[model samples]
Target: MSTVTSEIPAVEATQFQHTPYYCEENVYLLCKTLCENGVADATGSDLFVVFISNEKKQVPLWHQKASTRADGIVLWDYHVICVQRKKESDAEPLVWDLDSTLPFPSPLASYVNETIQPSFQLFAEYQRYFRIVHAPLFFKHFASDRRHMKEPDGSWIAQPPPYQPIVSQDGILHNLSEYNAMSGADSLSTMDPDTVGAAVSQKLGVVVSHTQLEELFTKLP
Candidate 1:
């Protein structure tokens, strides 16, 4: 397959809105926004996938980490990213994870090569099974729910303030190291989160309440 160029000019990394703690979902929406507004030449509703890893075994896990509560409860079961094209002509889709500590819009090929050590995949059918709208609509209805996360210190704060870039300038190459495990693609196999996601969140000192879980899903299309 040939490489397809992006529809829109690739915005410099610094242009991205900075945030305190943008989680997996926030980036999914951001990428979808890029696609919808033709920012990256994206068209239609959007395309994204949700995936879950058992432990530190999943490389992406090492980057964004998962959503949790102050009491240390886990919320979301999977990490999701928008798989979109910068333009209609692009060959392979780009995987955009705004919260990723690795890089903002990782090429799907590179993403699969480095991340995607998976046993199961639940392609988030936002357009098919779920309805996806522009950010304004989402905010009008669910902004309050979407905002805020429990900090390690136990204070609740807003997430992904605005255009927070995925990876910081301080450790560009260092953050990329998370996917070092992907280089061993020949040895990789598919696997699911063997341990309960909540249990794992507890171990990480994060908590997701029942209400929070509902907000995570129902609020989105």
Candidate 2:
């Protein structure tokens, strides 16, 4: 038997914030396959099916919620997976394939130019996920768990600080304009962190602990 050279990380249940959407669930599995086996076809590919919410236009018809008003949205930030395909070669039998499965309906359907720009930008950024396997890139999306923080004097802050990106994946660093355009975010002149710690402090207030933030910042490029 051939000895395996490396091990892969599995999708932790906590990585997902919302209840796993069908697309999210599929992509999660696809990511695992890609991490382990590289890239392949639908039947043979071993990558998690990554899902990125289409920020442009309304959600796709197929991705829409059926009965309940359940945030029947299709497009999201982004999702991606790596697949393995067999090649006739003298050495290794498999090679990696990056397949982007857009949640947008009819993906090629024409739409108003204005709404489409943002979604396409989001799609481009999602491509960066592959860099995670080779090098770390700083991609920060923040959500605060208010339950975990307490002010030293015992008062609660309404909102946490804005999130900051930390470098954990390989890719070109994102420019301010790129970040703003992809996230549809306003100028962060006043709030974004030049350092991730500042960004966390801005959201969590001066009193909140930043032990984790401190550790992540130590690895910055």
Candidate 3:
């Protein structure tokens, strides 16, 4: 039952990033800002910000694809989110998913256990779910450090100031607009996600399918 105050400014950072791809870092930065702003009650590890990753075919909420579904949907590649529980206050833990692309801030279990039907009634081509992984780790984007195994072979390329991190409200909004833009005039209007999924899978070198990660999901119907 924990809720955000809505007082802090998205000018610093946010989870609702609109990058064409690679949202893990966006989520991480957003969590960092939330922690700074005391989203999970005065920060610290109690906030329980963990990284969730899994295989996905198309980008849910954004990707364009064919649909026999009431809302034929697609999935995204590795995604990240924050989880926290205020035992002393709220009765339930809240998922801080800013880029949720859905009604957002959905219950953690609902986001985790819900199937392609309820989830896809809005956007899913078939009844199939993929495996998702949970890790209690925060991934780093900028290579400020972690530069190891660097021989004298000029292994590290020099990145200038912009290499730091781009945290801007305007920029974020632009990216979000670009990412969520979907209309008959858009390119996805002509692309078939089912057929394009194979190319996506091959390029990503990951197995993306219209199948269920669990038999339970497959048998739900």
Candidate 4:
């Protein structure tokens, strides 16, 4: 694991306000804000939107503030966060999970160890899979109609974000499912390293196993 150092100053977590239970929208706003503020360009960091889920849609995450248990574990259908990969070789990547109780921007290693818990064994149904999307392409191609938060009868499962639903630059109305769906067979270990970047950018994204999560950004060119 890469050690956390003070060389990089922390970004205040409270600087942005996030809507509860709206992780995908929260991360979308985060990436937009960071780009508008020039943080991505100034730091030479590439941003990625990571969706955590599985074929069964029952992914377990720890250290989530939404957990009712003492261990801060939550069984979520899906969850999203923003990861920033610095261009500098010595600087560790950072995870920005607005819903987490951990540091605002936790180091990738610490987030994986504490929140992801890749070392912990799990049943086949609960094993985690990650869909990693390059932020620039995601920003351009992503759209959400908020249909996922509704009941079959049209009642809301949860309150919706105050802002209007996000639409893709090319006028795609809804493609949330395209990004959220993860199959067990789409592990990064199976892909050629040279094609990973192209695949992620040209398509929706790449789905990787829990064990392959941390090394993903490092391996991408």
Could you say which candidate leads in lDDT?
4
TM-score of every model? 0.41, 0.23, 0.41, 0.91
Candidate 1: Cα lDDT at 5: 45
Which wins on TM-score, candidate 2 or candidate 4?
4
lDDT of 3 at 216: 17
lDDT of 1 by residue, 132-209 (tens): 122222222222222235567866665434543333233332221221111122111321232222212221211222
Q: Please provide, for model 3 over 19-57, each residue's C-alpha lDDT reduced to its tens digit, 9 standing for 90 to 100.
A: 423344455455566566666444334344333222222
Give the TM-score (vs. native) of candidate 4: 0.91
- In model 3, the runs with Cα more than 4 Å from the true position are 1-18, 54-72, 113-221
Off by over 4 Å in 1: 5-9, 32-37, 40-46, 49-78, 85-90, 101-103, 118-154, 157-221
Rank by lDDT, highest first: 4, 1, 3, 2
Model 1 TM: 0.41
TM-score of 3: 0.41
* Candidate 2 lDDT trough over 10 residues, lowest sum: 129-138
Better of 2 and 3 by TM-score: 3
Q: Estimate candidate 3's alpha-carbon lDDT, on a 0 to 1 scale.
A: 0.35
Whole-model alpha-carbon lDDT for candidate 1? 0.36
Off by over 4 Å in 4: 1-4, 42-45
lDDT of candidates 1 onward, in order: 0.36, 0.26, 0.35, 0.82
RMSD of 4: 2.4
